[model samples]
Target: MKNYILITLTNALGLYIASLLFPAITLSSIAAVLWAGLLLATISLFLKPLLLLISLPINFITFGLFTLLINAWLIQLSAYLAKGVSIPNFKYALIPAIIIFALNRARLSLIHDKS
Candidate 1:
């Protein structure tokens, strides 16, 4: 439970940073960032696995590159569900997804090394 909350907060921070860095991504307010972050975390936790399972063959063939697309799709879906989060286009969502994915990889590696 604590881990879930931490992950959600990290995602929120990532989104906040993305919004600051990308003109195409916008959060109407701080509350909006929180809502968007929660929505994104929920979608990632729930929908992403199903999509990943459904696309497993392609994921294998693409050498896991399809996972990036899945991340982007989740981002787009979260933006659609969260009223105050706006992604102007699918292309814009890709960048933030990639950024977040890279950050997560770095974080996991740091934890792994520490352990």
Candidate 2:
């Protein structure tokens, strides 16, 4: 539960930062940010592992760089499901996906460091 909340908050912060960095990514309101964040976190938790497993061959062939594409696709998926959050296209989503991935890694490292 705690981890879920942390991931959601991190995702929200990432989305907010992405919106600031990319004009093409528009989050209409704080509520939209929160909703998108929650949706993203949920999707990442439920779908990401399955995607990684299914894409293992391609991911391995790409030296794991294919994970970025997966992240971007997940971001696009979240945008599709969330209201008032618009990511123009897959190209526009890549950077934000990178940002969110960095944020999630940083958050995990911080948590690990505390333990």
Candidate 3:
């Protein structure tokens, strides 16, 4: 539960940062940011693994680079599903995906180092 909440908060922060960095991505309000974060976390938790599995061949071929596309797709999906967050297209979502991925990686590394 604690980890889930932390993930949600990190995702929210990533989205907020992305919105600030990119004019193409927009979050209307704080509520929108939180909702988008929660939705993104949930979707990533449930859907990403399935996508990774399905895209294993391509992932292997690309040396795991295809995971970025999967992350972008997930971000696009989160934007579509969560109201008040707008990502114009898949291309626009890629950077946000990268930002979120970095944030999550850093978070995991910090947690591992502490343990």
The models' CA-based lDDT, in order, is 0.84, 0.93, 0.93
For residue 115, what is the lDDT in candidate 1?
88
Q: Model 1, residue 5: what's the lDDT?
A: 73
TM-score of 2: 0.96
Worst 10 residues of 2 by lDDT: 92-101
RMSD of each: 1.4, 0.9, 0.9
Model 1 TM-score (2 dp) = 0.90
Backbone clashes under 3 angstroms, per model: 0, 0, 0
- TM values, all candidates: 0.90, 0.96, 0.96
